[model samples]
Target chain A: MKTDMSIRMRTMLYGLMCVLLIPFVFPTWWMVTSSVKPISDIFAFPPDLLPRTYDWSTYQRVFELQPFAQQYWNSGYIALLVTAGTMIVSSLAGYAFARIRFPGADAIFMVVLLGLLIPAEVTIVPLFQMFNQWGMINTHWPLILVPVFGAPSVFSTFIMRQFFIALPIELEEAARVDGLGRFTIFRKIALPLAKPALSAVAIFTFLHSWNLFLEPIVFISTPQMFTLPQALTQFTDAYGGAMWNIQLAAATLTALPVLIVFIVAQKQFVEGLAHTGLKG
Target chain B: MANVTLSQIKKQYGNTPVIHGVDIEAADGEFVVLVGPSGCGKSTLLRMIAGLETISSGTLKIGDRIVNDLDPKDRDIAMVFQNYALYPHMTVETNMGFSLEHRGGTKTEIAERVKWAAEILDLSNLLKRYPRQLSGGQRQRVAMGRAIVRDPQVFLFDEPLSNLDAKLRVAMRAEIKNLHRKLKTTTIYVTHDQVEAMTMADKIVVMNAGEVSQVGAPLDLYDRPANRFVAGFIGSPSMNFIDGVVENGRFTAPGIDLETPSFTAGETSRQLICGIRPEHLVIGGEGISAEVSLVEPMGSETQVTFSLPEGTIVGVFRDRIAAKPGDILTLGVQTDGCHFFDPLTDLRVE
Candidate 1:
């Protein structure tokens, strides 16, 4: 009798979990399935969950519509730059804020944390004007620089700070007694042990830069200069009607690589974030 | 080996003071232990010597050079920490050799030094294992190896064995004492355990409330503490202090009175505290009558708690005493071993 009840409970739990997972999993499924459907089949009364026929031309048309490959490259490289840059800048600044005892460190850290309070929308006008004055408006400068150095990366900095703070202080002290200076100790001891936090920050920063829409739309003008999000929106027709198939194809192209990478290395992805001292 | 001298050492966290002016001197190759209860600033003092803590105001000298502003690397000192502090990411060999690698030593030299230290620490087979993979005792050996491989001018230990279980702690304590005997580097060890200080140090400095109460050989501090704090702190179970009045070569408490050798010392009106170690009290004759409260028997000796007219007192006896609770008994104190201190200042009034 107990075994029967436990088996029933397990089945119910699996059923509930799949239901809970649908909200997050459904949109990606719809996007992929609709991307390959014929334009007529896309809006069929049944609303195809799986297309009977694939519109292969729609995939090629996504690239033909406004330098889509270049836009993909722009998003990929910008995210790479942002991830690398944020990892360096935020880790160094975070470690300093957490450990080093320079004069006015706490005061400076408070000012840095104040970046969290001001929304990017509040500073977007100034940032756009500043980038324009430097003739970097049409370039990928805003997309790369804003997330790496601005408020977006502050959360990354906060995460790194939390991890570094929990690092056993005596490890660094032992490094000191081993005759290491502050910088050497940080590089050799503290940073290596901080791999989990760094991986978590890297994933978060990359995704943030990858999905950026507002900053790219505001700063970029040339269609060739557009990032993936901006390029995905350019698939509208002259009548201002949505090009559903083409846009879905481009959105899949933009989101697939990261999704596939996450799937393959999901253990590292989940465990890295879990151990980033964000357990609470 | 080098001598370390701290003259007028003081530490302050912003406006709040932690360590008041302290003067300590560790001779070349001497094993000196700084012992005190927790929050007494002994670890802070050791850290200041290791150059991990900034000396708020004072001159710290290693050999003849003043090292007050020098970095820890420039000071050439090694320290073993309470938690061992092995680098979690590095293998035991890499952790031991990491400092030398940073100092621009050749890879071969670094490896050779690491190998040498590993052999000494019996960590040869475990050199490739990371800290997380090793047992606590293994990690502790790696921490010690990291310190010794540098062959620095001095070594600082901040209660390095305090985290271990009792059996492991005793084993490690003897190993450390043997290591010190072999190397003979000038070392400053800090621990709250007086037994560690007693068994390992050539000299012991007892601290209380951030100030040194006494500095002497371990037995000297045990047999003749300079102040009441040291007397109470140096022995296990602590020395018992009894409040009393001294008049005309006699000291009188509530229920106990005793005669002492005549001395024309301090003011007779001044109140004093008399102290006796538990071991000095004996059963029977030439003493006061007391009510037995409790008795605890060890393999070699029994400790009995008794209530005298003045207050409660404990006596340790090697002979088996046929006494139980609620029985009246006479207790004698070894007169020569008694200590008197000025109650107000807590300083010995010998």
Candidate 2:
């Protein structure tokens, strides 16, 4: 009934999969291995599957070159704040759009959906001008505030709205009869049941905030204020010759937290996206 | 306990009216059921009483307070949804005690009430488990437990047993009825299933297309339906209506003629519908000839579908009928069991 593959068929399938995995997994493997390889051997023939000679000094040089730890903290805190802020804003907006009935709700939701149409690049200049007038340039305010409140969160709000819409309305009715007001019902019943969608939003907002290069580079000029993605490019010698091994080492460190987060929350993330009701 | 009264309660979605002024009164500790086929607005009327849906117009009173503008929580009522609507994330105890918690009950008080409700619902052992961990019937009991934990003034149930299997539905039906008996709380139950309405309701409100067709005690409605709709809706197999005219003390149609009841004699040479329950059709006697079209043996009773020259009618016989399709069977109508209705208005003609 299962129609399971034979062992030989499975072996061949695994072999095909391993071969297919090379394009996706090999880069991370190379980046990790290349971080430990001697600078001269990084581009060596056949591309040493393992490091030929270990150069632990590259990791030391990564920290010595710039305020690497400070930059890591900047990215870490910004991502966390963005994740939390986006979660709050999006879940509330989503709940309102999905559940609450009011005049012009549909029109307002359509306007919000318009945010999904305009790419971030198209709004960057206007946003930069707006933030400049607010004296928010060179601060983490733009990095955090824009994603949490602006276009980036539109997707999160959309996801949350879809999730909240899929939820049974009877639960809220029952909660209302249980003496919960709208806010209390949202907090106690709706929000607790929204863990999957929230996780999906968290992962998305965190990764988006962490990998943000254009915004940080455009907004932040201070060395210590650079996030990981921006800081990774700062690992250069005086002559501006790219410090290959040091850069790779910093990039490897930059990838670590995101990797760990995804590993920890992959189940919920997958389920959340799947349950977003996007599939036909 | 409180009595619920709806005086001309109406509802409309935008310009479209759903409940066109329904009036129902459930005396204190009475079990009232709103029942009808789908889209009959029975559930909507129940929701209006529970304060889930806004009443477009008319006065809704819980006890003596007009509750038209009050929130569901302020109405002092608890409802069990059709799906049970147990908070999936919370344990049974927390779910049962959620209302009390919202009302600022002390933890000890909440725990005591939850314990009492759990014990009554036989969910004491399962209080620590989540709703997803319980069976359909257990989840149903948990929903009931949640309702009873707060001891609200009234209870509302919206097809609460509909999600359960047949056996569980019957068990839970009795359990709910027994619970109502013990608590003696004013309860309004809504279901489309006539069997549930007939077996469980102290009074049944039969609705048709957003209007209350009849409201009476179960047997009273069954014995003497006020209208044709109530007669058709209150029975399991449903009453079969044969269109005929009463003339010279005989009800005559295309290929059928029968002795009319004494009360129906005054309407001579008038068009009428004679409604007869499936069980009231006698299999053998001096009567109209009908050819058996289908025979369904349902354990204790054999349900036979017969084709009278005018129309098809169903009959339930206690004795096992060996008649197959194409066999002619003489069927007599129980004279006392006959109901005469005006064909034009579909109203009972006494």
Model 1 C-alpha lDDT per residue in residues A1-280, reported as the tens digit of each score: 9999999999999999999999999899989989999777877886777889888788899978779888888889999999999999988988988898799988888888899999878999999989989999889888998998998688888888888888999888877766777787778788888888888888878888888999998999999899888888889999988899989998898998789767776665676667665653
lDDT by residue (tens digit), candidate 2, A5-122: 5777888999999999999999999999999998889898888799878888988888898999999999999999999999999999999999999999999999998988988889
Q: Assess candidate 2 and give its lDDT.
A: 0.91
- In candidate 1, what are the lDDT values of residues B13-44, reduced to their tens digit? 98988889999999999999999999999999
Interface RMSD of each: 1.2, 0.4
Model 2 regions more than 4 Å off: A1-5, A278-280, B263-267
Global lDDT scores for all candidate models: 0.87, 0.91
In model 2, the Cα lDDT at residue A202 comes to: 91
Which prediction has the highest TM-score against the true structure? 2
Task: Give the winner by lDDT.
Answer: 2
Estimate the TM-score for candidate 2: 0.97
